[model samples]
Target: MIVVGAGPVGLTAALLLARRGHDVQVLERRTLPSELPRAVHLDAEAQRVLVDAGVDFAALSSPGAGLRLLDADHRVLAEFPREPGAAGMFHQPDLEEQLRAALARAGGQLTTGVGVVAVRPVRGGAQVVTDRSGDPVLAADLVLGCDGAGSTVARAVRPRYRELARPDRWYVVDLLAPAPLPVWPGVHQVCDPVRAATFMPVVGLRYRAEFRVTDQPLDLPAELARFGAQDCTVVREAEYEYGARVARRWRTGRVLLCGDAAHLTPPFIGQGLGLGLRDAHQLAWRVDAVLAGAHDALLDGFGRERAAHARALVRLAAFTGWLMTAGGVRAARVRSGLARLLPSTLLAAGTPPLRPGPWVRRPRVGRGHGVGRLVPDVRVRGRRLDDLLGPGWALLVCSTEVPDLPELPGGARARVLHRGALPDLGPALRDRWVLVRPDRVVAAVGPRAQR
Candidate 1:
């Protein structure tokens, strides 16, 4: 197996694949890991992926308080409080280091300073051609493009692409502050049409600020004059394009696209990193299944599922962006009023669950309800459910008696819990069993599994 790019997504894909006994090789153009962190923070769902990969999130990330939507005057419009398992601000460099360590532990090979010039489909699998001075060529059973938005592999695959938002420049400013931070460690989305920006406290006293591009390059000192020039020192100033896009197809034969190569969501939701992590997690098991002699069609669902998920998140980010900065004065008033009137739960994460796809089993009793929703971490007898489930399907048998359970295509274990043990199981499990996927998403709910 060959994976392109060594970002979090690529390294993670290599780690998961190698863990399954696959000989995975990762190719990267860069000579070394990045010194600066790009991604600001990760939520509980994304944090779960790292934990499953053997990372200790509690030690790596600071405790986060979730996100807050503020008005022009900094008055709170809405806030989404982080749940107990939610992650705080995580330094990207630290995460990359952890990913690299995990890959090494899994025995995955990572070659830096070597770039893949092209990936061409051969008779059975694909051939990866690199741009090293020697111009080495390697054969692989499968190829994954974990590269960024301008992925060479994605272009080679020639999948139809759609742009959700026009690329707009945004200025980012990182700062190092002395002890006694000026602001609390929380994300503040400033919703001001004059100058929309995102403020986050990175790591300790380190802070990051992002603002939509302005006519004149923002003078960091002047823009942040309120902070008092002596309080913080500027680390770096950079500009990046912020937009949303997704590929129509994720896989073309043995060549596949994941991470930024597959979709790009606005930073409004901070799901950019999480989505990539999700792509890796979703594809790893299926790739294992296909290699295990499952039907080739089993790999057909990757594109559809990821596209749906990316589209939903893109829409949510765009909607939130509008509520934050799009509207004019009159619209802003209405938005503020609506924000105040709306229930706080609506602002919480995991609002609308991803629609079930080929990989998901539609619920028989709830009419597809809870089918694709991610299951919150629940502990039983002082052990986390995921820790107990390990990396396999979980059969939460709740029906009075096990009605001939269906064989899991990828193997599963039967775990029966007494009634009321997990109240979050809802009424569905009271009379039926629930099939949870390895990624901890509810797969199906019925008296008996269908297949």
Candidate 2:
């Protein structure tokens, strides 16, 4: 399989596929990690996806302060604290490095400094035409478009982008702070009529600031002066247009899009990279299954599932942008008041559970409530379920009676759970057997297998 763009999403998808014994090839146009400012807030869900992809995220990250809403004068409107063991600040470039290392360890090949000319379906599979000399035209059963917003694979399928909201432009500033500023550690969303800005603190004394563009030729030092962070070395400065958009279709034929190729969420919700990581998580499993002789429609189901999930978050981000950038003093006050009323859970990184479909079995009234949701961090004999889930379907038999051998998909071994074991699962698995897909999502919940 060929994966385009060696960014975190591409590398991650490549790694996951490689771990499942697939020969994955990654293509990247840039020789170096991107200098463009990227996502800093990685929720716990995204972190779990990375860990499953073989990345040690904790060592590479620092604890992050939670989200805060502030008025034009910088007075606190509300604070949504990070949940226990929730993610914090992280550097995108560092994550790329880790992904590259993990990909190499998993035997995935990454070719940098190569430009992809085009991606198209040719016969039974897809092909990636690149500018590389040794292997310019590579064809595989699958093609993944992870190249950012301007994806060639996406262009081959659906060229039009569905704009979810009015695009907003901002002057982005990245700096290396001389010292840690604990006083302003959390992400501060400044809702000002004059300037709708975002102030952020990163790990290792790095800082980022964004000011909504009002006029041309912005003064960097002057902008930083207002934030009391002018005495710092500037890293990169650029004008970035943030948008809420998703591809018309994530898949068309053998080629599939992941990450920014599939959708682009406004940074208001800090889900830009997190959403992409989720793509890597769900896509790898389906791709592996398809390669193992699963139906072509499986990939289609993946496209439908991810598109719906991504669109929901994109809408939320667009609404957040409107709430934080409403004009006028009276509008700002109204925004602050709304922020005060906003439930902390609304802004949390956790997402809505997957809707029922091919990948997620629709739950019955109450017995299969855990279906379509990611299994909790339940442990068996002190071993994490994460470690137990292999490259295939796993069964967590919660019902009584431990069958010597249970008939399941792939003839999987069923591990029966007794009361007091895996307390994290609690009553979710009280009287039903939970079938977990390779992605760690609960696929189905029903009675224990008798055979």
Candidate 3:
């Protein structure tokens, strides 16, 4: 398999594919990881991806308290507190370095400084033509374009995509904290109409602030001073424009797009990284199954499932951006009032549920709620639920006896849990069994186990 773009998403996909016994070569334009921070957040779902990919985050990340939306006067508008299994904040380079190491450890080939220039479909697969910058012509059974928004691979395969919205530009500043501040450990969305901004403390002694600014360049240090960050070391200062967009199609023959190559979202909701990682997670297993002789139709639903997810998140961020960065004082007031009335679950990160799809198979015996959602990790027999489930598909049975089930696409196991092991499983699994995918998504729920 040829995986384009060595960012987190691409590296992750390659690592997982290689782990599944496929040969993967990752191509990247940059020779090294970015010295400055890029993505600063990853929820538990992403943490799950990292664990599945064998990228350790214990040394790279810390828990975040979620987000706080505040008015221009620094008054709270809506606060989304981090739940028990919510996201974590980490340094992008640290996480990327770990991913690179894991890929190497998994025996996946990583070719840096080579950019994919063109992709052409061949007899049974696709050929990825690359720039002569590093590697040469590569042919593989599959091609995954995990490249960013300005994806050359995406353009080579398909020229057009739907632009969801016009971009909003913001100046981003990353500073090495000279010392700690008294601020809480979370993102502060300061909804100042004159200069809306976001501030957060990432892993390491790093602090980042992004401000909505005019096109004119300003003294970067002066801007940091305004944030009372003058004493800190400046890591990087640059302007970034973020908007909503999704490719008209994610798959063309054996070539497919993932991550920013498929969609782009404003940073308002902090889902940009999570969404991409989720893409890699959702696609890798299916690709492996197809390679292992499952029908190619197994992959037919990949683009649709991911496109809908990307659209939902982009729309959510767009709405959040309007409340925090755009609109007038009257709009802000109305938003504040609504925020007060909204439930914390609605406001919190990782609250949205994925809709049912071909991949998210649900049993017909019961309502089978939570079938499409990522299953929460719970303790089982003194070990983490995931640790007990191991890898691949798994069946968690609430009843005393484990039922015989048809073989899943990937091999699966049945683990009978103690009656009260998962209190949060709720009535969804009462007198039933839950089938979990390799990525730990609840694939199905039924009275008698089936796949």
Q: Which RMSD values do the candidates have, in order?
A: 2.9, 3.1, 3.1
Of the pair 1 and 3, which is ahead by TM-score? Answer: 1
Q: What C-alpha lDDT do the candidate models reach, one value each?
A: 0.76, 0.79, 0.78
lDDT of 1 by residue, 1-451 (tens): 9999999999888888888789999999999898777886777777777777777767777877777877777788877777755656877888889889989998999999988888897765798988866558989999999989889888778878788876767888887887746665678887776677788777876788888886755666765653332467878778998778888988878899999998888887678888898888878878887787766576787778878888888877777676667766776677677666545443455536657665477854455566787765767778777786668667666545654656654543555544345545554444457767777777776653333
lDDT of 3 by residue, 1-451 (tens): 8999988899999998988889999989999777768898877877888888887776788888878887877788878888855778888888888888898988999988887778987866888887784556788899999888888778656836777777888989888887886677888888776678788888768999898886455566665565567788878888888878877788877788899998899887788988898989989888988787777776767887878778887888787777567776776767678766655653463635566776576666557677888777776657667776666777776656666666666443445554445645655566567777887788777673333
Considering TM-score, which of the candidate structures 2 and 3 is the better prediction for this target? 2
**TM-score per candidate:** 0.92, 0.92, 0.91
User: What order do you get sorting by lDDT, best first?
Assistant: 2, 3, 1
Q: Which pairs of residues collide in candidate 2?
A: 64-88
Worst 10 residues of 1 by lDDT: 411-420
Can you write out model 2's per-residue Cα lDDT over 187-256, one digit (the tens) per residue? 8888888888888887787889999898656677887877778888888888889878877687877888
After the best TM-score superposition of candidate 1, give how far the Cα of residue 173 lies from its true spot, in angstroms: 1.2
Poorest stretch of ten by lDDT in candidate 2: 403-412
Give me the displacement of residue 42 in model 1, in angstroms: 1.2
- The alpha-carbon deviation from the true structure for residue 20 of candidate 3, after best TM-score superposition, in angstroms, is 1.6
**Model 2 CA deviation exceeding 4 Å by range:** 35-37, 133-135, 216-219, 367-369, 378-383, 400-420, 426-431, 447-451
